[model samples]
Target: MRGSVVCKKIAPVGEVLVKVFPTEIIDSVGEEDAHFFGAIDTATRALRGGGVFSVSDEIEGAALLHYINVAESYRNEGVGSKLLDYSLKSMKSAGTKYVLYRETADNPINLIISYNFATDNGFIPIVENEKILSYKMETILGGKFAMKMMGKKDSLNNIIGIDDPKDNRIIKFNEDNSDVFYKLEKGNYDPCYSGFYVKDDKIVGALRGVLRDKTVILGDVYLETGYESDDIYTSLLEYVLILLTQDVRVENIVIQVTGEKRRSIINSLLGEPDAERNAIELVRYL
Candidate 1:
C-alpha cells in the first residue's frame, strides 16, 4: 500500500470508503488492538498505498489514535503526513470533536517528537492508571439466565441501596431525594447502554458491551451485595452468551476484570484457556 489516492465523499452512505490496503500492511503495526482507515486513488479508483491505524472507541466524543504508518516504499513522500491530515478532516466532517493519540513510553525513536504531532493537532495527554498482570481462568459453567433493559434511574438507586453501607459515598444514589434517579429519568444520563439480569422485577446483576470491529467486549459485571446466589451469576453469564450468539459480526468475546474477583467466575463460564496475557497499560479517550 503506497501512492497518491483521490478522496471521495459518498452520500446516502452511512459508512465512508477511503482506500482499502492489504490487511497485512495494518497487522505490521504489531498491536492487535489497532483500528485502521485507508485512502483511495481518484484516478485508479483503487485504494492508495498508505493508511492510518489507531485505537478508537465511542467514548468522550473522540477517537484514540495509537499508531500511524505509511507503507515503507512510500515513506518521506508526504504520503504519511497527508494521510494524517485526511484522517482529521474526515473525522471532523463526521462531527467528531476531539482526537486522542499515544506513543508507547518506551518507544525507541523520537517518542517526544511523535507526541508533538498530536499535540500540534490540538490533542493533549491524559494520565491514567497503568495495568498489570492479572490471573486468567479457563472455564465456567453455563446455565439458564434472563435479561432485561432497565433505566439507570431505578437500577442505580437499587444498586446504591444494596451496596456496602461503608461505601455509600462511592455513588450518590439516594442523596437529594435521588437526584441521580431524576437525571437518569430526564435523559440527562446514559449508563453506556448496558444489559441486566433480573428476577421478579428486581435487578440481580448487570453487564455492558463494547463493540470493536469484529469483537464484542464485555465488562463491568456486578452483582448485588449479599446476594451470593449461584442462580443470579449464572443468569448473568447466560445473558451474555445469548447476546454474543446473536452478534453475527463478532468472532470472539473478551472480558476484562481484576484477577482476584474474576478467577472463579471465569473458570466456571469460559472453560479452558484459549489465550492468556496481561494488559500492560490501557487508556480511554473519555
Candidate 2:
C-alpha cells in the first residue's frame, strides 16, 4: 500500500521510491512483500544503504510542518494519515501554539479546504508583508525643539489635557487606560519611548512607540486635531528619527501611514525624493 506521512517539528524521511515488478517476483514475494521489498530497495539505493535522518531547529514560538511520501504501491493503507497524526500530536505536546501547511496560492480547491481545516482546528489566518521602509536623517530641524521626556506617573490626566473640550476628540489622553498599558509603561516607558511637542507647560502633540525585538514601532500620533498641517506631523516624525538615530544598532525604522496622508505632506518636507519613490504598500493582519 502507498501512503504519505505528515509531521510537525520533525525531519522527513531521506528517501522515497516507486517500484514496478514482473509477475514472477510478485508471486514469489506475495503482493504485500513485493511492495514492501520494492520500497525498501528503493530507499536503500537512494541513501546508499544507510539510514537518513532530517532534523530542524525549533522555531521560537512556531511549529514546523513536513510531509513525506511513501511508495504508491502501498497507498491507502493508512500510513500517510497515521504519520501526520503522530507529528501533530507531538507538536501539540511540545507546546506549539500554531501549525501551518503550505499550498499553492492559485490552488483554489485546496485553499478552500485548508481554510476550513485551519479554522476548525482553532487557527486564525494571519497575513504578513515583506515590504520595509528606510528613513534617514537628512537634516536636523530647528535645533531639536526643547522637549522633556516625562514618565506616565507624573500625571496621565495632565499630559493628555482630557478636560480641554476644545481638543478632546482629536487629542485623547489615556485612550488605552488598560492594565496592559500601565504595565508596559512601568516596564519599558522609563524614558517614555515616545515623542511630544510642548508649548508652554502643556503638550501640543505626541507620538508613541511600542517595542518589538530591538526596534521600536511608531504607533499613534495624536495632535490637537485642527493642527493637521504639515508642520506638526513633520515635527513629530522628526522627533522619532532623532531618538532612533541615537541607537547605532537600530538598522531601520517603521511607520504605518496611509498613502493619502503621506502624499499630503511629502512636498512640504526637505529630504531625499528617492525615499518617497521607494515607498511600499503596507499590509497588516486584523
Candidate 3:
C-alpha cells in the first residue's frame, strides 16, 4: 500500500528536519541552517513502507525539497513520486512560485540516486556549481506561475521604477520615521545606511544598506505601491555610494537581492553584474 501525503502550512523545527533526512545529509548542510528552514511552511508524506519525505516553501519563493528518506524495502514502490506530486499540488494551491532541490555532497552514489530521481520526476538542473546540484520543478505549478508573472510585467515595472512626484530629493533616515523603515523591510533586514524618498513629507520609497568591513551591502530597495516613473532607487543608491566613498575605508558596494527578478533589475541599473564567483540557485516557474 502506498502511503498518503500530508502537507503542512507551518514549518518544522530542527528536530523534525533531522528526522526527515539522514545524518550524512544533515552534516553536510549543518544544523545551523535549520534556523533558516524552520521558518517556512512544510509538506510531509508518509510512505506505507515506513518512509517519509518532506519539503518546505522557503525563501525566494522556492519550495525547497529538503529530504526524502524511504526504507530500503520501499525503494522501487513509487512512493517518492506520489509524495512529490502531492507536495507540488499543495504548493501550487498556496501560490508557490518555484520548487528547489539542492545536493551539496559529492558522493557519487547519492548524487546519481538524487539526480536520477529528480530528473525522472520532471525536475531539471538550473544551476550546478562545484559539488552542489540545483533543480527546478516542472510538473505541477511551473508553467502556471510563469504565465501569472508575465501578466504582471507592467505592474512590476512601475513598482521597480516608481518615483516621488513632489520632489526628487533623498533624505537621511532619522529616528522620526525609523518605524516606517522597519515596516517596509519585511525580512532578513539589516539597516545601516538607510534613507528614503519623500513626497509631500511622506516616505513613499526607501533604500536600505549595511556597511561592514569596508563593503556596503545594499539591502532592500523598494517603493510604495501605485507610484510610477520614479528613479528613487537609482538616486538613493547614488547618494549612498557618494556618502560611503567619503570614508577612506569604503572599497566596494554589493546589492544582495532576494530573488532572480530583483537581482536582474538591480544588476542592470548598477551596470555589469559581477562574475567573480558563481552561485547555484534553483528556480521553478510556478
Candidate 4:
C-alpha cells in the first residue's frame, strides 16, 4: 500500500477531489472560500490520499496548505509525507518564501499544525501576528457582511457606532501622512482601506485593512493608551467598516485583532469568535 500512491502536482479537481476528501470536508467548503484560498496551484493524489493548496494572497511569498486528507485505508502509510514534501518543493520552486497552515489552537492535532507533522516538516509556531490575524474570521462575519452589503444597516444596527461620519479627525490614510501611524514603514497600509482618528492634533487612533479576493482584511487597529482609548478604537473601527462598504464591494470581513478590549469591542460589533485560543499561524520557510 505504501508504494501504490503516485504523488504529483495538479491532481484532477472535479469529482475526483470530492471522492478523495470526505463529504464533511469538501461539502462545507464554498466556491468563494475556495476562491479566497487562491491558486488551484496544486492537488495531489494516488492510492486514495490527496490535498489542496493555495497561495496566501494577503501574506506575501507564502502558500497556504488548505486541506490534506488521507483515506482511512491509507493512514500512517507515509502517503501524507510524500504529498507534503512535493507540495513544499513545488511552492519553493515557484518562489513561495514559506508555507502557512492556520487552525484553532490546542486541539488534538493542534488543529492544522499537526505536531508530529510539524516535527517531520520543520514548521514552526509564530507569535508575532496572532494578536490580529485569522482566516476563520471569514466564517463568522461573512454573512453579516453580506447583509451590510445589501444596504441592511439595520441588521448590524447596534454595532454601527458612528453613522454621522462628520468627524474631521478621521482622515484618510495615504503615503503623505503615513507617519501618523506608529509602524508605518513596516506594516501593511493601503490608502483606500485605511484611516486615522486624530484628536488634540495627534493621531490618537487608526485603522487599516488589506483587500484580498472578496474579503477586506481589517487589521492594525491602534490607539494611544489613554482614558478614551476604548471609545477611540471603537469609532475608528466602525469608521473603517462604514468606509469600506460605501466605497467598494465588500463581501467578507476578516479582522486581525485580539486582547480583552479589542475582542470585547469586536464581539460587540461583529459578535463573539471562538476566542478560546489564538489562531495559530505555522510557517515553514523555504
Q: Write the per-residue lDDT of candidate 2 for residues 1-286, one digit (tens) a residue.
A: 3223332231222222212333333343333321121122233332111111112222223443322344454455644444444544555565654454432233356456545543444445432221123343333232222122223133222232222324433223334322221222322331334665555555556666655556565643556656665566666665565566566655444554444555444334333222321111111111
Whose lDDT is greatest here?
4
Q: Could you list the CA RMSD of all candidates, in the order they appear?
A: 11.6, 15.5, 14.4, 9.4
Worst 10 residues of 2 by lDDT: 47-56
The list of candidate 2 runs beyond 4 A from truth reads 1-5, 11-131, 138-193, 196-235, 244-252, 270-286
lDDT per model vs. reference: 0.45, 0.39, 0.46, 0.56
**Which one wins by TM-score: 2 or 4?**
4
Of models 1 and 3, which has the larger lDDT?
3
**Candidate 4 residue pairs that clash:** 132-256, 132-257
Per-model TM-score on C-alpha atoms = 0.37, 0.33, 0.37, 0.54
Model 1: lDDT equals 0.45
Error of 2 at 82 (Å): 14
Q: Which ten residues in a row have the lowest lDDT in candidate 4?
A: 34-43
Instruction: Give lDDT: candidate 2, residue 159.
Output: 35
Q: Write the residue-wise lDDT of candidate 1 on 1-286 in tens digits.
A: 3335654322211133223444443454433544455545555555444344443333434555545555455556666566777766766666555665644443434555665555554554443221122222112212211112222133223231222323333233224223111211212222333355544545446555555556555653556566655555555555555555554665656664444435455555555345443332222222
Candidates 1 and 4, the one with greater lDDT = 4
Residue 115 CA error for candidate 1 (Å)?
A: 11
